[model samples]
Structure formats: C-alpha cells, structure tokens
Target: MARGLGATVRRFPAGDLAALEAMLTEAPPGVSKMICMDGVNSMTGNTPNLVAFAALAREHGALLYVDDAHGFGVIGERSATEASPYGHRGNSIVAHAGETYDGIVLVGGFSKAYSSLLAFLAVPTWLKDHLKVAAAPYLFSGPSPIASLATVLSGFDVNAARGDAIRADLHAKTAKVLATTTALRLATPNTSGLPIIELPLANPDDIDGVGHFLFDAGIYVTLAAYPLVPRSEVGFRVQITAANGDDEIDELCTTLRALAERFELQRHAELPAQGRRIGSATPDAEVRLSA
Candidate 1:
C-alpha cells in the first residue's frame, strides 16, 4: 500500500483541519488512493475532521474510505452510520440513495453501539463488479457460520426495537457522570455515549497509588502509563455504563473528590483556562486587558 502511494503514508494529527489539508495537498505526485480515516479515532476522541477531509481528498483526485466501527450506531439519528455529531455526516451521503459524495465507502460494524459481533460494509453499486473480481476474501471465504449469523440477525432485530430506550438510558447515565465529575473538578472531554474518563497524573507513582487506592475502596479504573501516553501524560482511564445508576455515579464522584482532596489533586487545572497569546520575543508590545 505504501509503495502504491509513492512510498509515503501520510498521517495527520486528528482534529486538525489545517494539517489534514496540508498533507493531502503535498502527498507525492502519483498517489491516487487514500484511506482518510478509521472509525472512532482514539487520540482525538472524535472522528477526526472526516467531512472536510473527504471533500479535500476528492478535490485532490483521491479515493476516500472510512471505517465507521466506532461511530456507526453511535452518531446519527437511530444510530445510523454517520459521523459523531462531532465528525462528518456518515452513511447518509452514499450515492445509491441519490445522495451527494457519490463514491465514498463506509465500513460498518455491529460491535460497538449495537453490542453485537457482526460486521458489514456499505459500498457504491459501481464497485460491486470490481469487488466480485478483485476482492479475494469475499470470493474465497466460506459462508458465514449459520448459528452465528442467526444470532447476529436476532440481535439486530432486538437492537432495532430497544435501541431508543437503551440510548436514552446511556445518555442519562453519561450526563450524570459528567456533571458529577465536573463538580468534583476532574478533567474530562465532552463525548456522546462512550463514558471514558481520563485523569492525567504527573508520574508513574501517582498512577500506581491512585489505582491501588481506588481498588481498595471498591472501585476499579485502569491505570495507564508511559508508552500508552507519554510519561508526562500518565493517568487513570475509567469506563462507565448505563448499569451505573445516579447513586452509583454520585458515590464514584464522592470517592474521587475525597481522593483528590487527600492527594492534593490540582483542581485549578481541571477548570478550563482562558486562551492567551504572547506578543513577541521582546516581551509584550502593548498592555493586554484581562476579560
């Protein structure tokens, strides 16, 4: 793939449109095919600027493909295959249904939001012939296991019926947790149903200490350290679910606040900071007023 793309595989920092544009514009001359994005990109906690990136790729005469594994049922209405409200309008724009963005392809899976193990793809009609001829896996692989297929189909039906109620519960639980965490002065990013809370600790000792403390207190959150995140960004990762009621969330928050107070967690850092700009190398050119 790298050789096919002129021996270069360009990667852009997620959520940065300027960087994505620059990469697309500067890709080696002969490169024509480009895989623009993966499902829910881990780093940015978003789909990475897919809508804008898709337009840019087409302008540059390249093919764009997106894996909607992490976003399919978690984004649009009815959890339709679309970008997170934060990303692009996903499967909504395929050409088959008289939509714009004629040739884009989206790979969907039932694993994340639907909580199933089946996977599927959405491709344009023109590509069907090509896929039949060039796609080796589809041509050579045996039929899907009957029992597994039946179970998956059954799960899909259940998901379609109960999806709304499930999503509502998820949203309520997420909102409760987020509000509680914010009140407790824990830094967390705004997200949809994925209740991932990341707490950045200063060092490995702090990470270990916090993990042990939480475990002893009957709460379990993952401790992540260097290599996973830089040494400077080590912390704990907590995942919440709909099963967590308001009382449980409150308890978790209370426990976190107590721990923070005991450990002297930097609450000030948890609050959002105002943006500032330094004038030049030779100090400030003019006095800046604080808002």
Candidate 2:
C-alpha cells in the first residue's frame, strides 16, 4: 500500500526499536509517519514492548498501529491481584502491557481464542470515521455471518464469567510443554510461554519425518516448512488452549520427549525472560516506515 501510494518504505527486523528511533529522529521535519507492528508474534508467542512503542509514536507524532491477533482474548491488563501471568480481561496486549490507545490503533480477531470469524479495530474517532468511509473491506464486504456473531456474543459472556480461570488453565498447560522442552534440553523460540511454542529442528530436513511421526502419534502441530520459514526456523508449533484435556497435554508432552530422543533436537542455552521490541512512524509525502 505504501508503495502503491509512492511512499518510501524501509523494512526492519522484528524488535529493532533502536533502528526505528534513528529513522524517525533523522527524518526531515513535517513527515507524517505511521508506525505498525505486531503485539504478540504468532511464530514465537513473544510480545513486543507496546508501552515503549506507544510512547515513541506519541513522541514522534506518528500513528501507532498494532495487530494483536495472537494477543486478543489471551493476554490483557496486568495487576497485582491478577489470577495468573497471562493477566486479566483478555483485552489484548495493549492492555496487558498497561498502555493506552491514545495514539495507537489496535486490530485483533476472534478466530483464535474466541473461535469465531470476526475482527475488530480499536482506533480513535477520527480514524474510525475515516475507515468507515474509506476502507474498501468495510464498503465491499458483506456482514459477518450470524453464527459467527452469535459465537462472539456468547464467547464474551463466557469470557466475563470464567475467563481468568480459563486463562490460568491455559497457562498451566502451556507451562507443562515449556517445562518439558527445558528439561529435555530442547530449544524453542517461546520465551513468553503464551501457548504458541515453536520447537525448531536441529536438522531442517527432518521436518517431513517429524510431521509424520507426530501425526502417527495422534498429535497435530503446525509445520513450518523451508520455503515458508527460513531453514533455521523450520520446525513445528504447538498451541495449547483451555479446552484441551489434561490427558491430551500429557500425550503431547510424552510425544515431544520421544521425538526429542529419536531426533537430535536443537541445543541452546536457556534464553532470558524478556523479549525484543520496536515501533515507529512514516511521514506524509515521504512516509518512511518499517515492519
């Protein structure tokens, strides 16, 4: 879209905030910048620093846009009295990080946690008005199916009633997997412990065999193939939910341990608790931005 509009675009690696800061600081005055990024990464289950991102965007007079697809209905506002580390309310990463939506536009969907085909955008009134009229999808697409809408409504009720308990259950199940990985000396890019665990293979060529093995073991996982992801990140992803049975989780852990023993798993030192982060903006005519 930026290219279509003839704007200068610069791509940056995930969690490279320093680079974005330099770009924004060095840009000429009067450039209208919009910073865009993910709240919770789907691959790593890691979250960027939204508080810093929002502050940086506000300081630089840029619009901050966040796609929190993996975060919505999962993580939310943090508090001392919260039930678990996943936080409360399932309002998305913005709330989880204790950040305001003043200069931020948060987009998320119900497809993951809510299991519905619905999406939302939390934006300011001005942008809301602008998008309602200018956004092509809103103009051209039909309304969401009634079934989907109904699920969302009932999902909200269920969330309000026992959402924290559900999140706690989810967190525990995910912890089981993380603990198993740690104990087996297996490397995973899942520092957040937010359910999406990517266990990369020591040998990328073993992906097909690993997929077959897991399928035969009655465990389904998302396979990250070579062309889809770099060879280094080629592996499988495991997702845990509240509805998952304890026995199912046990079977998954057992299968994972078997897989680790059968195939040489990647070996790496335990990563620190924190994850990387970045956010920025684009100017008007120049419109420089990064992913």
Candidate 3:
C-alpha cells in the first residue's frame, strides 16, 4: 500500500510517546504526516492515550489516524443516568477528545465490539471528497449486500436501546473474573475499566502451553507473541463481553486461578497503572493490581 501511494512507512516502538515526539521533530519540510495507531490496541489490549496523541499530533502540525476497532461499543461513552458495573466513569476516548481540531480521523471495525464484519470511518466534512478518491480500499472494494446492511441496522438499533445494560453486564463479568484471578494481568489500564484483560507468564515461551491448557479446559483466548508486544513477555488476552454468562465467567476464573498456582504466574513490569481496583467477590482470592 505504501509503495502504491508513493509513501514511506516508518515503524516505531509501541506506545513510545517520547520516541514519537523525536521523530515528529526530526521530519523535514512541510511533509504531511499521520500518526496511525489503534484506539484500544488489539495485541496487547492496551488503551492508547488518544487525547495525548491528538495533542502531540496537533503540536507537530500533523494528522492523527486512530483505528478504534476494540473501543467502539465497549470503552466509549456510557449512559448518564446509570453507571457501569466495573466503575467506568468517563466517555469514549474519541467522544471526550472533543472536535476542536478536525485534523483527527478515526476508523473502527465491527468484528470485536459490534459482532459484525467490515469497518467504518469518521472524518471531517473537508476530507470526505479527498478520502473517497485517495483511500484505495474504499474505491476498489465491493459494497456489502442489503442483508448485511439490514443486520448492521438491526445491531445498531439493538445497541441504542440496550447498550448501557450490556456494558454494565460486561463490566460485571470482568470484575467477577478479575476478583478471582491473580496470576495473569489485566492489560487495560485500571482507569479505563476496560473489559479486555491479559495474563503474562514469567517465560515468554509458556504462552502456547497456557493457551492450549485453557483450550482443553473449554475456554478460548489469544496467545500473542513478538511484534505484538515486546519479546520479553508472551501473553494471552481474554475479552469480556456482555453476552457471557455468570457461570462461564466463574468457571474461567476458577480455572485460571488454579493454573496460576500450578504455573506460579508472577508479576511483570509492563502492567498498566491502577485506579480504584475492584476486590474479589470470593474470599482468599484478593486480586491485586501490580502497579
């Protein structure tokens, strides 16, 4: 894609704000640069600082492009009248980011948060025409059929009426699991109250064994390796959805706790900082945040 567009692709360390700023300062001339990143990173399950990145991009006279595939329905704004079960207390990173600077662009996919296919883009009015012509995927792809559109519409309607309720349930399920398990870590920041959690092993290579162990026990999760995260740690991610039942949540938590004892899962340095952590529902489990 970069070759087709006559652009040079530069790779950087993940979430390294200092290095990013350095690169921005060193760039020559009036070259238009875009900071392309994930809203809630998929591999590590970390919620990127959209506001800070936006501010940095604005400072550098550049554009910010966020792929909010994991955030759309899960981490964004909650209802005003009620509260999320996990004590989430803010708007979606994008919603809270404000629209003062229209230079930011956001793309979100339906697979994770919406349980659908394809993706959507949010852009300012000024860029619509340019993007239509310049975006290769949009120009070359076939349109989704009416049936899929109908389903998306239906999904939207369903979300509109019951999204908050589902979000609450999702948080509750996550809280339940976290309360019981201590071996693995939660990748999402405690302040974010996100449902995506991760557990890292002392040895990076143990991830495959842990993944297979979970699979045999009737639970499925993703085992991520290098490039997704630093090679020093190999981790698996578990996503909590509103669709999950209490029994399922309980069983997974119980099994993970057992494995933590078996494998002696130890704490790592890459864990996100904690806000106010939710305690275990069960006694003796007492889940503690590393930092």
How do all models score by TM-score?
Answer: 0.72, 0.91, 0.83
Indicate which candidate wins on TM-score: 2
- Estimate, for each residue in 35-73, the C-alpha lDDT of model 2 and write its tens digit: 888888888887876777788889999899899999999
Better of 1 and 3 by TM-score: 3
- Which is better, 2 or 3, measured by TM-score? 2
Worst 10-residue lDDT window, candidate 3: 278-287
Candidate 3: tens digits of C-alpha lDDT, residues 161-273? 87767777887787677655433553333334457776666677677678778898999887767667675556677877787788889888888876776664546445433
Q: Name every residue pair that clashes in candidate 1.
A: 82-90
Off by over 4 Å in 3: 78-82, 85-92, 96-101, 183-191, 225-231, 268-273, 276-291
Q: In model 2, what are the clashing residue pairs, if there are any?
A: 31-283, 32-282, 32-283, 32-284, 33-282, 33-283, 34-281, 34-282, 35-280, 76-96
| Model 2: lowest-lDDT 10 consecutive positions | 282-291
The lDDT, on a scale of 0 to 1, for candidate 2 is 0.82
Cand. 1 TM to true fold: 0.72
List candidate 1 segments past 4 Å from native. 1-7, 78-101, 135-143, 191-194, 218-220, 262-291
